[model samples]
Target chain A: MSSSDLLLGLSQKALQLLQEDADKIEKLIEVQMENLTTRQCPLYEEVLDTQMYGLSREIDFAIRAELIQESAGKQIMVKLERNLAQLYEALSQSKE
Target chain B: MSSSDLLLGLSQKALQLLQEDADKIEKLIEVQMENLTTRQCPLYEEVLDTQMYGLSREIDFAIRAELIQESAGKQIMVKLERNLAQLYEALSQSKE
Candidate 1:
């Protein structure tokens, strides 16, 4: 394979892995949203926060390593952050 | 550049980036160790733990993206963990 092809393959793989991690976090958010009416687990927020931090670190590293574009990483993070924000908003409303 | 050369360059860059992160954590550990006799910051341990977690996530992503070997990632983590353990041990002893 050519050098470009090699780079492309690596970049694609990196993005896919990051997306998978983001999906996991998204799932966490969805589960919390679904359980909004039920008694929420106190530790779920902490768990989600930690997972988000971990995923952000991964995205940053991938960008530094040139495995993925910075914008691509930001896009993944932005989507998650939005979901996280909604989850928090819902949680607060539930508390009120 | 040839594909092999490209892969080699990417792999080396990934290793270097990971090492840089690990070094920062090592510095954190060293600083905490040095300050063990002084009044310790209550948040230092939590900060160190968070940093370690972030670095581990980066290393895991690099390995998954085929930028670095699994053993290479593990080696970086193990070295930092050992130093972190030493710092915690000193902290505990000082508290006793």
Candidate 2:
């Protein structure tokens, strides 16, 4: 495969990992949300609503962009996974 | 509230953001996975399964830990959001 193809493949694979973690997290959130007292949700709602807005954008810069973007994407996913694992642990502990 | 309470609140808020992004991404992934050719899943399954293992642990170091952990968690959530935004854009482009 060509370089773009390689980057595309890696990007897709990394995205799949992200999606997987997201799925597990959603279920966790649902359980936590349900158990949270009504009073607590109101306290959190302000912060949560602001952050829950959305996600997406694009760019067309010219210098070695595809590979750079692909590499950065992979690193972000790795960091995301590590942080997520930590967060999951902390949240679980909080629940107990 | 005290500093520890502040840290705990911030950590919980950040976790909520992470959970929100994960939910959106999971839906995106499900759509992509459904559309993916059957042959492709086998190739990607190994990477996906290994990464899917799990998430968590703890540390008991002595210096300014709660604040540090909370700050680190916030930063990770910020980075995670930015990266997720980028990944969402890239994946959407791929689909198109």
Candidate 3:
């Protein structure tokens, strides 16, 4: 299987395990982000590795898991790009 | 440092290690992907784990590494989504 298929399979499997509530999944992501910011993720290195392999996979998963239309992913991408810039600005400001 | 910063830093560092040719980075990704399908990535599982933690990082890396613009990320993401679907269809055709 291609990595994407493997990932999509895993995504389908994981979501099967989840309750299929878009709100819950979004909340889950939010909570995950909160956890990342609040705690030290020692496993960050490992996770980042998988990310290199399947960055597109999780993105595709989020699209389906959240029932986001194709256009929505674009908006999300734009928002995330802006958010990262804002975050960097905030961090840079704090550092100065 | 935040995870994004860590990634961006590593990305900057890796590119520094590379020769700063966007084509080289894209070729590297293509080669890595071809290797993935041709060989068994025993490390795939670990990488996948990290991916859940930082999918956005690699995407950003590719963007900067390739010198793709803000809107280009969106277009790339869309093409990727389509490519994945095509890959899946091809795989299923092979299996049947």
Candidate 4:
């Protein structure tokens, strides 16, 4: 394979891995949203925050290593943050 | 550059980035250690733990992306963990 092909393959793989990690956080948010009216694990917020931090670090590292573009990483984070905000909003509404 | 050279350069860059992050955490530990006799932030341990988690996630992503070897990543974590343990020991000793 050519050098460009190799880099392309690596970049694609890095993006896929990052998306997978983000999906896990997405799942966590969905779970919390579903349980908003039922049982709420007090530590769910903390767990989600930690997971978000970890994913952000991975994205930052990938961008620095030239495996993924910074904009691509930011897009993934932006999408996740929107979902997280919805979840938090739902949680608050349930409390009221 | 050849494909192999490209991969080698990327791998080296990934390792260097990871090492730089590990070094930051090491510096955090050193600062805390130096302040052992002075004011304790009370949140230093929590901050350290969060930073460790972030670094571990980055290392994991690098290994999965094939930018670095699993053993290489583990070595970085192990070395930093040792220093973290030492700092914790000192903190505990000072408390006593």
Candidate 5:
């Protein structure tokens, strides 16, 4: 289907997931909207880059492990959580 | 500062984390934006309600159990991983 056909009215949560699963062009739009509205365009762009270039490649390498199941993706979650802690610290520090 | 003053640019992850925090009013906007961007808005809205009503109360009860540090929030994370597994199952079910 065309991009226009993919357009759908999604709630905030739905929109965010679409952005995360931006495997198709239409999803790209949803993801961009998420970035634009959140004003985290930079972060979104970086995540996209990481997913496409770095993260996916890393996943491929991880496959060589004994058993890399779906949960393996969660390995990156710690880094993401750490980034959140850093972001909170940064925001708090800037405020103070 | 006023809610208007609290307006800030957040990355997708940052925006998401802010949504999770949603303590301040300005944060309310960031959180809603996150809910809107994601397709599982029903999920987000439910989470907000759970946090405000059921979840927070549960946490208060949980605090009595000793511990209840920052890491305590991760308790809900198990539910998330389960849901991811369930979600994939549901999607696959629907597709098939």
Candidate 6:
């Protein structure tokens, strides 16, 4: 399958699992973000940014598809923004 | 960037974010897997498998690249297998 399709599938799966509890999903996302911040490579960082962005987009799709609750989606978004801010911090730190 | 590159980049980032805590990483993976299991489409299920397989390969690459601890890598593999089994089960259920 195409990468986009693959991502969509995984995103759908993830929503199925986590759609019931935004807090739990947010925590899991935090774990992912923590893993992302350890890399020093710019390319790697770009990849992280891209993946999170893509996942977020998929979450949006889930909402549009009516596959997930709006509250859950919003929780995910908040978590994503938090991780993104941390990612920015991590990226800036590596510049030193 | 190419899809492979994007996946690679994100994998590295995920390792960076999560290399320290195998349990935590596994939990996040479980969350992702749970999200993946909700889709009933064969194409979508294939996508989930592909994504996980790709991520596992990336983990192997990281091990070779000396980006993450070997023990952590093993943990990821275990978690991957567990999720894969669940994915299989989910796929089978949908086929019924």
How many angstroms is residue A14 displaced in model 3 relative to the true structure, after the best TM-score fit?
14
Give the runs in model 4 whose Cα sits over 4 Å from its true position. none
What's the lDDT for all of these models?
0.95, 0.38, 0.41, 0.95, 0.37, 0.55
Candidate 2 C-alpha lDDT tens digits along A1-96: 554465455345434443443444445445545555432343443332222211011101101122125455445445544554554465566557
**Model 2: docking quality category:** incorrect
Determine which window of 10 residues in candidate 2 chain B has minimal summed lDDT: B54-63
Reproduced native contacts, each prediction: 1.00, 0.00, 0.00, 1.00, 0.00, 0.03
Judged by lDDT against the true structure, how good is candidate 1?
Answer: 0.95
Assign candidate 5 its CAPRI class: incorrect
lDDT per residue as tens, model 6, B1-96: 555665555456556544433444456446645665464444654555445544554454345434456787778778667766776776567558
Instruction: Give one digit per residue, the lDDT tens place, for model 6 in A1-96.
Output: 667765555445556544333444446445645665464444654555445544554455345434456787777677767766776686567557
lDDT (tens digit, per residue) of candidate 1 on B1-96 = 999999999999999999999999999899989899986999999999999999999999998898899999999999999999999899999999
Tens digits of lDDT, candidate 3, A46-69: 443343234334344435333224
Model 1 reaches what TM-score against the true structure?
0.98
lDDT digits (tens) for residues B33-93 of candidate 5: 5444344345644444334433332233223222133345445444443443454455446
Structure candidate 1, residue pairs in collision = none
| TM-score of each candidate structure, all chains considered together | 0.98, 0.23, 0.25, 0.98, 0.20, 0.32
Q: What value does DockQ give for candidate 3?
A: 0.03
Model 4 interface DockQ: 0.98
Candidate 3, TM-score vs. the true structure?
Answer: 0.25
Docking class of 3: incorrect
List the DockQ of the predictions in order: 0.97, 0.02, 0.03, 0.98, 0.02, 0.03
lDDT of 3 at B39: 58
**Interface RMSD, model 4, angstroms:** 0.3
Query: Tens-digit lDDT track for model 3 on B1-96?
Result: 554454445345433422232333344344445555455445643443343234334344334333234564455445444544454454446446
lDDT (Cα, tens digit) per residue for candidate 2, span B1-96: 554464455445435543443455445445445555432344343332221211011111101122125455445445444654554565556557
